[model samples]
Target: MKFIALFAGLPLLAAAAPTQRALGMPLQGDLCMPFQHDLGTPLQGGDFTAFAWFEHEPIHPPIQARGLRFWVGGEPATYCPSPPVVHCPPGKVTAFSGGGYGLSVMVPGGQRVYVSPTGELGYTQAHSAYIPPGSFLGPFEYTPGIPFGHYTFNGKGFIACPNSKEGPTTWKVFAHIPNAIVPTSDIQDCLPFQAVTEIFGSPPAAWQYT
Candidate 1:
């Protein structure tokens, strides 16, 4: 079950390098902006290949988003959205290049983040979403007005693995019934894993409009 993205069309970089970003309600005034980031796992010593971007397809501005990607990291893992006053913001989810209300895709998860009664952790993708109820965003290591930075998702940073190979991984990411169950039959997979958003700076090399 390959996941659909929020915004589509933006050409992808080599792999999480530049030209993509997230889409959230951004923090106010000289704080942070959405940019490409790595879903770093401190446990693995940050080795494995897991990246995330706001628009999974990496579409440029002047249009709506195609979709979003989490856990597996799309083609070019990282991305760069529009300006805060224009589009992507600190810890935000960008839906387009230059800022506009666009489509926000839901992978297999529900609209909100939750944990199932059977122990399955559920999450979703949106243009403007709040951190979990009690969970607050970590800190801002951004350069005041920069389009890149880092932060902690606290409890929401948790993720799971699946029984299948790269194919099954997509199932786990999309889940079944939105806030339903994510199966894990692999021992080496879904083993109490978590990650942090590690971002690099946004540059002109990041995006191009169609």
Candidate 2:
């Protein structure tokens, strides 16, 4: 099944970048604002997409999320009152993007970064919480006060491949950042980009958002 985003009010404008300390590390594309509300979905193997504004430009092409890809392995993913899960083919399940909030960031150094309404919240361990939770976002909430920036690439970085099951699933979140060049901030607000959000995951299904 294909996924679709159902927003309520008008889109909020971008805010000044947050302090570096609150940022944790350098961010990419743009600094994303937190989702003050619940952005959830009721489908497995579907798609969710949203467009946000940046104070500057991105470093790679945005993602083109489309189509029914993977089988979340259980009931449809949900959020709001609780978190959601992005199940794999079988018992090995993980949550992709579904929480009370959303965030954006860059990788490696800073050559490229990302901004996503979908908060990729990874596995919940007894220790720290894993970001980019393992799947793509379903219902994305946008707000003002978000920051935006590009990456510089300090050294080598990680990329996701369809064959690497052990690789990080958060790649689905950053899939919209400019990976090769830079994206101008002159795109439409509600339209994600003049470009489309692309797909990232195995067989390209996990990252598929139509």
In the order shown, what is each candidate's alpha-carbon RMSD? Answer: 15.0, 16.6
Which portions of model 1 miss their true places by more than 4 Å? 1-69, 74-151, 154-156, 163-180, 184-189, 203-210
TM-score of 1: 0.27
**Candidate 1's C-alpha lDDT?**
0.27
lDDT of 1 by residue, 5-104 (tens): 4224434333433322332222223312223222242111111112233333332211111123233332322234545434422222322111101112
> Residue 91 in candidate 1 has what lDDT?
26
List runs of model 2 lying over 4 Å from the truth. 1-60, 67-140, 144-170, 174-210
lDDT of 2: 0.22
lDDT of 2 at 37: 31
Q: What TM-score does model 2 achieve against the real structure?
A: 0.19
